[model samples]
Target chain A: MENVTKTLDAKGLGCPMPVVRTKKAIEELSAGEILEVVVTDRGSIADIPMWAKNTGHEYLELVEEGDVLKHYVRKGGKTTDKEETPVKTITNEEYLEIADKGPVTLIDVREPDEFAAGHAPGAKNIPLGQIDKRMDEIPEEGDVYIMCRSGGRAGMACDTLETFGRKNLIRVAPGMGDWNGPIE
Target chain B: MKVAIIASNGGLFDAYKVFNIATAAAATDGEVEIFFTFEGLNLIHKEGLKQLPMPEGKEHFAEGFANANVPSIEELVGMSQEMGVKFIACQMTMDVMGLKKEDFADGTEVGGAVTFLGYAKDADITLTF
Candidate 1:
């Protein structure tokens, strides 16, 4: 029964929203403080715990009162930083410089619609979501370049690829949004 | 990460928000599933493209989005599917709404509350739109 330093009313908010709001709320609390969140979304039972685990916070407990759920979370003294991926990154200009120099494996991590809407010519569509299932499609030996709309998804893809023993991967950061190159 | 989205609203804006979040989650390598129930089932129907309309008083906002190059709800659904976001239509809702399997989009799957709850049970994040 830790003292609640703050309370978040996340009732009626859905997935991501509750977690998103909880994250912001937790930031305002001091280390070792507890934050109580009341939510009506049944999904929050799983969401809040997962979010806490991923972010290195302690998920204390949750109590359900009729339709409302009350979650207790203990803030970690220091928020754990995400692990650093070994993948290297390149600028859009740098990618262009090496685009036609030789054979390069460019993996577009954007959704197929976005890829179809416009993408760097000759780029292969291996969206981030399908990466696990499509890992075999990636060549074992090649200059692998991953790009997304911005750099976030590409970074995630790189992290996933790294877990699969991919090394020396290159991330096309600040991706297609800034690309002035030709589109497919 | 396993993410489940429960779409219960029929408004075009709500569907748009759901798809947008679904696609973004998929892009982040999250296992995303969108369950269409109640009025939300209309979003996956074959006729959804023609039937989707902005909620009352929000009709004017649609034009703003169109002018900004935002994709339509249909296109967003396509994007969500392409990004590996699973689309599930509620069987109970279909029965109540008089919708058949053939009435839904090509990739839509049918399931009941139990099925959705199973996914939600293991999901890292669950949302209802």
Candidate 2:
């Protein structure tokens, strides 16, 4: 296609593969450059847009012909994990042990639907995307435990919060998705 | 994430769903293990794809997938294994189906419920289909 800088053929891949590959391909692109992802996975129709939105990229358009879909996305200046601060990490077992003792300011960084399904009691629902705006809701000074389905989103939240001057943040890796503790 | 999948159906669509999810999870940096039991073992059988049945009213799926070049269940199975998704066929199912370990593709593990539960225990996501 005209004006297409590069093409990634993720054809025949199912589910999240197209999106996962798109993330890597887009990173190799300079700001304002475009990456074309060709895939047969229909899920990418919705998944690609959501990924682009979450990663600060511009989803240009999707061209479809038969089973093939060509997705155009323009690279954003900064990455979703640009300010990555590899902070301290804790496991689900350790988090559970701490929670059993008393109250902990655990921030569940997953979406509302996931939170509503199951979450730690007394855990705040400040999703990773909304953390920047909801920073005030967190305690001005205290140890805050951040968690998500696994740990990726929580790590992102920690990075974003770190940029906002959060000092006492601990991440729960292998997060709620592996939690054997009580849920509210 | 560590993902544990229980595949208990042998239908074509069912096989596709399981393999699709498994391969996708593996591609997304998740460690995936699929435990095939009951009728699900048909998927790993050497001749299963040739005999795989289309679900009622969804027979067009085969034509559509073929026309679109979407990988078949067999292809998806290969892709899943290539992506490092562990494949475990049930020992009891093998006896019931009169199949031996050699009846499946190379590198498939044979295990029972205890093995599956051991892997599923620490899994972040457990799905049954």
Candidate 3:
């Protein structure tokens, strides 16, 4: 049994709650410390590990006791810096300038319906959630620019692509929310 | 940050707020969960798209939003789910309202007060509307 620095009782909570409580509980611990989360939401079995991976925490183990689940996570000293990526970002104005100069690969990471509602003319629709499984769909050779309703999902997509060694990625900040360009 | 939202109102303005905040929080890596009870359950009903708006005082704003290409409540709900925000409908409320599992939009789970309370207890922030 690992030394438990703290324990969060999230039993009966569903979906994101268990993960949410675990995140806060982990924050209170010091580097290399351990946090235990007990939850009854079966979704946490997958959610916790994904959250740990996304946030760069160590998912030590999961123990199922009866209908409850005990998850052990080791606090990472540099969790805050783990998500930092070297991807470059460009302003919407700069993106428009570049697009006007020549054809640019613009990837809209919003949902299909959102994309259908309105999107930059000639932009490719590859939603952020499906980016990982659909990476191959993105051309390896091009100046790839990503955008969402806002710049947030685009930033996340840039980080995800960076991890996969995809360079030449540029994030369009102040995305569609402030896009003055014509929509398709 | 962890935000637990208890939405008990079916009003469009309130539903918009719930979806907006939930999606925003998720975007910033905050874990978010919304529990819909009482009238709020109507927001997730299959026919919710038609009944989403408040009955008064917001029609012009709603029209403006539509014309501006702003997302509707249904679209916002979809966006929130894409951002990993969890939407849960109250089971006891469903029973009282004669709603079944099929009555809600896809991706909604039915839960009880205990389940929602469990979430609120551990959440860093909790709000009711």
Each predicted model: what fraction of the native A–B Cα contacts (within 8 Å) does it retain? 0.00, 0.14, 0.00
Runs of candidate 3 with Cα error greater than 4 angstroms are A1-184
In Å, residue A79's CA in model 1 sits off its true spot by: 28
As a whole number from 0 to 100, the lDDT of residue B95 in candidate 3 is 86
Off by over 4 Å in 2: A1-5, A10-35, A39-42, A49-184
lDDT of 2 by residue, B1-129 (tens): 899999999998788789877876665567999998989988888788557888889887777767655566777777777778999999998898788999886779999999999999999999999
Instruction: Choose 2 or 3, whichever is better by TM-score.
Output: 2
Docking quality (DockQ) of candidate 3: 0.02
lDDT of 3 by residue, A1-184 (tens): 5557678998766544566567667765555557899988787788788778767688899999999999998876532122365558888888989999988889999889989999998899998889998999777787899988656667777778878889978888767877899899
lDDT of 3 at A56: 68
Better-scoring candidate (TM-score), 1 or 2: 2
Model 3's CAPRI class? incorrect
Candidate 2, backbone clash total: 0
What digit string (tens of lDDT, one per residue) describes model 1 on residues B53-118?
787887888667655445667777776776678989998888887889888877888888888999
Q: Using TM-score, rank the candidates from best to worst.
A: 2, 1, 3
Error of 2 at B34 (Å): 0.1
